[model samples]
Target: MRRPPQELWETDVLTFRKMRNLLPKYVFKSLENTIKQRTKLDVSLAPIIATAMKDWAISKGASFYAHIFYPLTNITAEKHDGFLSVESDGSAITEFTGKALVQGEPDASSFANGGIRSTFEARGYTAWDVTSPAYVLETDNGVTLYIPTVFISWTGEALDKKMPLLRSNAAMSKAATRLLKLLGHSEVATVNSSCGAEQEYFLVDEHLAQMRPDILQTGRTLFGRPAAKGQQFDDHYFGAIPERVQILTQDIEERMYRLGILLKTRHNEVAPGQFEIAPFHEEANVASDHQQMIMTILKSTAKKHGFMCLLHEKPFSGINGSGKHVNWSVSNATQGNLLDPGDNPHQNLQFLLFCGAVIRGVHKYGRLLRAVVATAGNDHRLGANEAPPAIISVYLGKQLEDVFNQIKQGEVTSSAPAGVMSWDVPTLPEFPKDPGDRNRTSPFAFTGNRFEFRAVGSNQSVSGPLVALNTILTDSLTWVADKLEADLAKGIELDTAVYAVLRQIMDLHGNVIFGGDGYSEEWQTIAVKERGLLNLTTTADALPILKEQDIQELFETTGVLTASELKSRFHAYAEQYIEVIKMEADLVISMAKTMISPAASRHLSEVSATIMNLKQIGIELEQENAERVASLTNQMMDTVKNLGNALNEHNFTTIEEHMQYCAKTLRPMMDQVRKYADDIEGEVAHDLWPLPKYQEMLFIK
Candidate 1:
């Protein structure tokens, strides 16, 4: 007997709720305390904390612990080990050591390193990141420890994502301290960059997802005919969340909250089955760690609800792709925010100078900024209507732009414009704010106190982009500090010196500031021809910019990343691009051969048999039916042959060679193969089609 849907779903929800309620509040409390205290690393504390974490996890039925780290591939890595340790008496104990808690050894040969390590040299080290708290993960068997760590090769080369991120954080802090001191803020000791990433993703039924090999392997649908309904109406944006999706969102949020991640918002996105989740901003390092953990938790929790979370940039055709909008800002130990414009910001010299520093940074390293968000998956999304284009520019709404323009013109301004807000109810509240509207099409938009980098891909690690942003800002601030100090030494008034610097920067780099449509062709022409901004359209084009002499000097001087490390990253990205394309190609061939071909062949045979039976009864087969079967069969056969041949021809060895092949040859062929298969699918009977139809997967609850 078929089980009742409500009963089964309700049971799952109840169990998940129980798990959510059982999570210890003290875990997050302890984490909060740690962040505030800046406690020294006490080696003795590891075992005790590990024991408590293990106990909590085991109580929830987790069996093993995994040291989770982020590697160079822009994805999380883990090496699981059981908690059992055998004593001399042949008894097993759940043992965890402080040494084990501090470090781990894993084979690094399989990971991409851009020639940092050879295949034979397999050793790599994972050191626990003391700043990020340890967490417990509960599974079907028992609980396990999840320690955030940084991976490095035996020769001391950084092999993972965390090292560069940590280095960038330190660099930003140092640069910010210097700037603060120069601005007469001696009380401020430390400054840190903060980030709140708004993650967008799609959810589709697991059964339907499993039926499609492209999604199963690649986390995206490599081929699908566009549905009659897409995001054209924009009805899904902020729309009411569906019941099943809401349940999944609630479950994921509860898990993240338990893990000390502050998930703040969840809502429908522009595309159907697509949603976005945002959290309150935290220090960049912590924010990146939390973002990584959130993606994992979301996928796992969604599976418990019989859905698959799609993190691919362009999961389906003709709809908005997912992006991780990185909201970035800076704060000091004493002051609240460096980016906030006070009530009378036009008169605030410090605020204007800081703003000028950012504008200068964006203008100076715009290509590097584009390079940060470059990835194989992201190429399809950027420059499209659904996302901000590859052209790097800053959007400082009308009010701020006008303020800066006035400064550049050497005009004395009295008061800046105030932003407006309406509460709708007459008696409730009303407020005036900035005199500008937001531009969703802008790649980098200043929203209130922070800059939202909208070009980041959903599947990418936030660290890379944050690292570039922080490093560039650090360089820019350092330059501004030098100029300010020189002016002050020459006996210039602070306000006058600040205005002079702002004017100089505005006059030189003001072309990067655009408060208009970034998607228009006219803007592209202006950005390139008049403004002289770079448009790096692909990972291949963008990665090389990192090797520029100026970029290398910037990183080396800031101590954010060594030139060697930067080269490794460039190589890693190039190799990863090729591997991703190859993986997709392999999946396409597998699906075409096993699922598409067989289904189409069976349908063709059945149609032929029906025609024969009708002909035996002295009635000729319908011409339309006969023609449809023949055409579809021939197309399917040709597609299969072409795709198979393309796969066989992938003989490139180096990463560069492979990338060129994929971009110039492989991807286009795959598209051609998909076209015929989709046409055949549309012609075949519904039940005979191999994969789930777009309508069913997208619209079904």
Candidate 2:
């Protein structure tokens, strides 16, 4: 039966709602009540809720439950246990207790902790994070209880992502409240960090994705020729979403929305099969939890729709990569957005003060800000033409920058020029457009009311970057608040004191502000030599800065992260970088030796045979074809040997040594290997290639 296009889209949306509706109604209702209460979990209600959760899971045919937590690895961990026990009557029974609901113990020795945990001391605890609700994973046989929790070691050392994120939120809120109070907004309470993360990803057909060993193993195509019809035409950006992709997106969005995630936008991106989904802003902690859920659901939903979601920064070569653009801002229960510039921001003293605080934060801690987004996968994306450069800078637009300049020059009555808008009717009122234009190339850009951090990697847990952002902003805001309090106590007028601080901040750290192109070579030179900004280019270069005296003092004073916890995170990130590189190198060597090299050799043999037969029969074959095949075959052979040697020589004695090896030897060799393989792919016949080509995988329905 042929279905109408609109009906087809509606069907996809409906399918998603159905999947979400499969969950018990009471579960969602409980979440709603929980959100409304906005308090610590009631001890009395714990058991009742646990019983309800157990019963719901049992009804869904669940036999086991897992306390799922995000560890230092930045990925989720789960420890599953069946719900079976013997009753007094010698009958089988399933049971779950409040204690089990509240906490679980998992081994911690293997997890990275910067020497916090010894091999003999393997115990780790998972304490339920009541802020994030539980969900059920229905498998073919039975369901699994997925409890969101925070992991910690026996000695109370934080060993998970959630703890730091929660602490950072608290830090930001506390500091923000202090600043708000100074601005005479005493009614405002419970300041919160809000984030709207735009998740970008690529969708390839599951069958073709699985056929490529590199994609299957590395979450990207390690080597593939560029597709003839890439995103060069720019037709794919915000273009009509493909029907199959639309179905998958609809299904995912409905599921997410039902789970209380406010998904706001979905559209095609610049790369083929690359799409972005953005959610409405929410409290930073809730937003981070939802971001993780969105990624998991996107992957699962894509599978159902016969697609594979590639969240890697560079899923394909010669095309735009994916990124998680983290839009961040602060707000309060009463005052709304702290970052918002109302109709006339020039008169809005509070908004200008907070903006100055952000500018100071980004300038003072730009190195740490760069460190937040550093990752092995992201290393390939950053500084490329498609993404933000390595240098950290803020884009405040022309209006705001000029306003700050005017203030710094001691000018009074600084105001934006009134803009005009025409209405069709003569009696109708006219409106003005926004005062500033957007700079997509900027790493930290102030859009309407929030700063969009464009450098965050797609697969990263937004928690890490948001944590850094909130902590740094809190530190800067505290400084601003202290200065303002001292000035007011010294009998300086409030407006004069505010203006003094804003002017001082702008004059000192104003160099970080740039409204021009961030991707240009000229900007890079200006950012470093001209502005004297730190350009920490890689994870290795940036990770060590976390331990610097200034950063340590900032984290300690703000109480966002303890020194021990920060060190643990440093080790975790450094180790993760080396591990990712090793994995990629191993995959490259395996594919080159087992798949690409052999295929190239076979093609070479066939071409040589054809050439020999043509010569024997006195028939002149195309010399260009034979020469092309020979050149590619020789290049592939040399690259494979070099890649094998590089992989074999990698010293994995220590994490630091391994990371050094990867940076100096393994990565460069792998790139070389991929270069030759990609070249060969362009020359080799499609039938002779062992894996699916880029054109087929990118364009196939």
Candidate that would win on lDDT: 2
lDDT of 1 at 69: 90
Q: Compared with the true structure, what per-residue lDDT tens digits does model 2 show for residues 526-578?
A: 98999999777777677788879899988889887788888878887888898
Q: Using TM-score, give the best candidate's number.
A: 2
Please report how far candidate 2 places residue 79 from its true position, in Å.
2.7
Residue 453 CA displacement from its true place in model 2, Å: 0.4
Scored by Cα lDDT, where does model 2 land? 0.82
TM-score for candidate 2, residues paired by index: 0.91
lDDT over C-alpha atoms for residue 348 of model 2: 87
Candidate 1 backbone overlaps, count: 12
| Angstrom error at residue 153, model 1 | 1.7
Q: How displaced is residue 135 in candidate 1, in Å?
A: 1.8
Query: Clashing residue pairs, candidate 2?
Result: none
What would the per-residue lDDT of candidate 1 be over residues 77-182, giving only the tens digit for each residue? 8999887889999998887676787789999999988889899999999988767756666667656667789999998888887888888777877777787777
